[model samples]
Target: MLYNAVSTLGLSKRLQTANTELQLERLRNNDEIASGKHFDVAKALGARTGQAIALRNLYDETDQTLKSTALLQGRLGTMDSALTNILSAGQDVLAAASVGLGQPSPTGSSLQVRARAMLEQVVGMLNASSGNGYLFGGVEVKTAPMRAVQGDESGLPSPIQIVQDAIAAATGGTSSPQTPAETAAAVAALDDLFATPSASPLGFEGGFYQGAPSTAPRLSARLDRTTEIPYGIQGNDPAMRDLLQGLYMLASVDTSQLPLDAYKPYMEAAVAKVSGGIEGVRDATAQLGIHRAQLDDIAAMNTTQLRILNDQLDAMESVDPAEASLRMNQLEVQIEATAAATARIARMSLTNYL
Candidate 1:
């Protein structure tokens, strides 16, 4: 059958489409060279799209968790320093109290001064903020967990007085006793407060802690695909509270008013509490160390996983540089041939056709 005259519209459209395809190929090559990956993430992976997507999502989540872990690490680092200082202060108080038992006026004044300084330090730590939130406030991240000054129904008296009264109440009543019995009572009171703060008059509600629910959701960070870590040591923690209580008691003592015998008992009680505080802080630091180790392991796993995922993705979509260059060169030659053919075809006359 005789063919109709070549349609000019179709020829022009075909030429335009060929030129567009060439441009798109060049653009895709450039993109591959620049990105070192497939031009289209999903299309390149084809049957492997599900796994590629899942791996990408997993990496993204792991990356986000690592970021969060970094931030939490900073906060925990601050806590570590604060707790160390507090532990040291407790040791110092014990030493000073020991010395105070020997010399009445001067040594006692020194202990009191040191205790006051430590009180400031401890309170500063308790109310410390990292980034946008308080360190010791647990879930109540924005609020200060400890107050240096005294308060009314909303809060208790100065840290020392509240501790003293709590101790007194634990023994029997809040009546003043100029004896060793009072010191023992104060120790019992501290135990009572930590044990059942809400039940006791000088509970966490009335005294020191000002944070989220009593059992706040722990601050957490991602460890891996199937693991997470929870943390956020609060001010009301027995170890921290005991440390503060020791500092308060040391600051409250008056060497002149009480005889060395009475003073000795007070210091003894304070020393025991302070020692407990030191142990508590040490334990917290140790636990933080464990978390840091875990993060390191998780980070390593994340890096390895990401590398493997990237390799798989590259395999799916990456154009070999040498092959891409050869293909590009081939396309360039084809275009040149097409241009020549079109030029020759355009010049064909009706006379030549007849």
Candidate 2:
């Protein structure tokens, strides 16, 4: 038989290609074992490659959004907890103030001292912050929501200062008391100031909040492509305003300092105001509870979506170790056999046989 040189060379080249393919198969199997993912994504994905990639991108974006919402939820949650504590403190102040109505001890007494401490706690909570941001500062996250300093200056509209001045005028505590007409005029002035704003303290003519008088903006988070929800409140809700007014009213009116006969009307009004404040705080806290519940729901949905998306992605991208190993072994054996055939053919020369 005639030895066709061209055919022999072609056969050798084919064997070399097969050997390279075998080495690549072995490397791929090793990668699959180490990474648990397919080494040949294009081949594994086949006709659905574009669809699978799009789905993966969507999953990643949604996951990122979910993580951000979770962080927001945490901030809101911290604010909610602080508010809850303040609500309890407000209630405690009311309960203490309501004790022994006519027989109460004088200023610096147990009940009055406890009321002052509780007022301090409420102020601290209003000024509370979390994660480097003011929880109740609305869009002004970096600034504290309330000014907590005490002021006795005349005509100062700061809520605490107003409360302080009123009580001082009524009882000769810091300032001298006024006569019937003068005292009536002072009470009317306070009544006009509080009632003018009517809706919220933010609406008050003189700034009730130390921060900017801008209405607190609600914080919003996207849950999905078409769903966005607002989940934040501020220090200036009507309910919060009512609570502060109630607390400060009680704090200012030291029943012991005032003449019980003359200040009977003032003391009775303070008690009524605080009682209403307690209910207002509960209402505000309940509203926060609803927001938290919604947040929990969003978190649950996010978790479920991640689980399903990850499972789907894994099914498309993961390789089975046993199957990859068997294929690798088959290629290795074929490469060895092909190498032996090519070497044997190269050595068979016409002259050597003769």
Candidate 3:
């Protein structure tokens, strides 16, 4: 078959262009070695590198979150243990008080002293600091949750008096110690205490102390953080209130004057209430442990997921040096041969034979 020379030349030129493009594509995709001024190489590397960078960032963020959760779980666990100890101490005091009240000679005076000490220890635990700040003072990190002032021999302040005074001052009228006559009157008084705007120095109003006052003098008895959930138990809570009231009543009672029969119920009631409080604390501690365990499980799962994702990313983007080296050598030889062929082809001309 007769072939056209112009067509043949065009075909040769097209074949050369196609071969050059194929070589460039292979080099770009392989990315075995850093190539200078190759657009295809940059494009290929940019795509794969971007994916790797994104994966790495995701891994890093997951790791950080896992670490933070771990820290929170650990803190919670420590706080739980402290609460358990405080509960135990409170129980011991109540038991001692109960036994003492039953006896005629009342071996209970020593028990009272021990109970007072334990209560003080409980206070210290509630104010326990986690190095960052107090754990139990709610958001008030700098201040202790409970304090015993010297006003009375009692280690705790008169909460009822404080509330009453604050309410009276806010209302500008004395509250009836007896019944309020109507629910509306009582609600109105409460509204007055709570409705005072935050702009007023008293804070969110409601006669409630949000956090320990910064300027308020420190209490002689502070809650211990090392042995209790700092501020886990509130003074106003019924269990604590009953326990304190019982203790105060016991302290005031003249055993010589009062018959054992009259005091028996008081001792029994105090024991029951205090025991209940201890159980409450134990239950709370157990719940915290459960929460901590859940957090640990979540962290472990996240870690495992991250590891798998990292491995997948590595497989997709990472190069094997040995395989890359072999491919690179083959491409180099092919490129050299292509160059030599092109040079030889270019020198050939019809005029040389004519």
Candidate 4:
């Protein structure tokens, strides 16, 4: 066959183009081997690139949501622990009060002291917090949910003083109730003071609560696009109010100063109030347990969804290292062969053949 200049030039150009193409293929395959992922995901996936992007975005969002859920779970757990501690403290006071009623102590001195210490302990627990914020603050998480028992220079009456004033008002400035009628009136006044919109100027809400009010929205967390859980418990809750009221009633007066007429009726009322508070706290704790279970379920479902999403993403975007390496080796050999052929064609001449 005759090898004309035009045909030789055409052949040489084609070989050069083939060599360059093989070189590019080798480079792409090498990259795939190193990275374990498609070098150009959009190019490899074509029209389906959007699906891959959406899937990856969804995976990222779910991961973020799972992290948030974990934090919420931690907060809920912290609140539950604090509330359990409060229950324990309440029970201790109940036991002390029951013992006082069962046996005679000089003016119930031991019971009074126990109630005061436990009252402080319970208030401290109600003010518990974590990295996120205060556990019992409701929607207000930055500050302590319960005020210190001692009022500040701001002139607010201390919690103990509030209880004392309520008693004085009910008993007509007497140290203890004068009769059964006075004892009943004292209990009613104490209840009113600790009620939602307290009757006294320095009642529970006015003097003790430092967090969100009852009318404000409760704290909550979102598990997903559609699921939200409200798990906040405030210090001013009715159960907490009753428990504190019972403790304060015992702690505020010296039982030694009281006549039997006042002391017997008073101790019985406190015991009953504390008992009711214990039951209410247990119910609240049970409700928190239910919420925790719900969070566990949501977390498990999120884990499963993440796993499936990861698998799908891997199938779409990952490459096998062994296969990529093998292809790269083949491309290298083809590129070398094409380069050798192009060089041979460049060296060819009519004079050499002659």
**In terms of lDDT, which candidate is strongest?**
4
lDDT of each candidate versus the true structure = 0.70, 0.66, 0.52, 0.85
Q: Candidate 4 clashing pairs?
A: none
How high is the lDDT of residue 291 in model 1?
77
Model 4 sits at a Cα RMSD from the real structure of 3.8
Model 3: per-residue Cα lDDT over 15-76, one tens digit each = 58856975885666365445322234335457676776677787787777667666665666
Query: Candidate 1 at 235: error in angstroms?
Result: 0.9
* Model 1, total clashes: 2
lDDT tens readout by residue for model 2, 160-210: 666566546544554422344433444444454444354434223344554
Indicate the worst ten consecutive residues by lDDT in candidate 2.
174-183
Give the winner by TM-score. Answer: 4
For residues 1-354, write the lDDT of model 4, one tens digit per residue: 985545778899999988888888788887888888999999989999999999999999999989988998888888899888989999998987887674346747777788889999989999899886888878888978787766556587788887888889899998667677888899999988888887677767768887888999988888899888889788888888888889888888776556667767887888888888888889999999999999999999999999999999999999977778778878888888898899999998888668
Clash count for candidate 4 is: 0
**What is the Cα-based lDDT of residue 108 in candidate 1?**
67
Looking at model 1, the pairs that clash are: 167-186, 197-203
Q: What is the lDDT of residue 339 in candidate 2?
A: 83
Per-prediction TM-score to the true structure, in the order listed = 0.81, 0.77, 0.54, 0.85
Candidate 2 similarity to native, TM-score: 0.77
Candidate 1 stretches greater than 4 Å from native: 1-4, 41-45, 102-105, 149-195, 198-202, 217-222, 340-354
**Residue 140 local lDDT, model 3:** 60
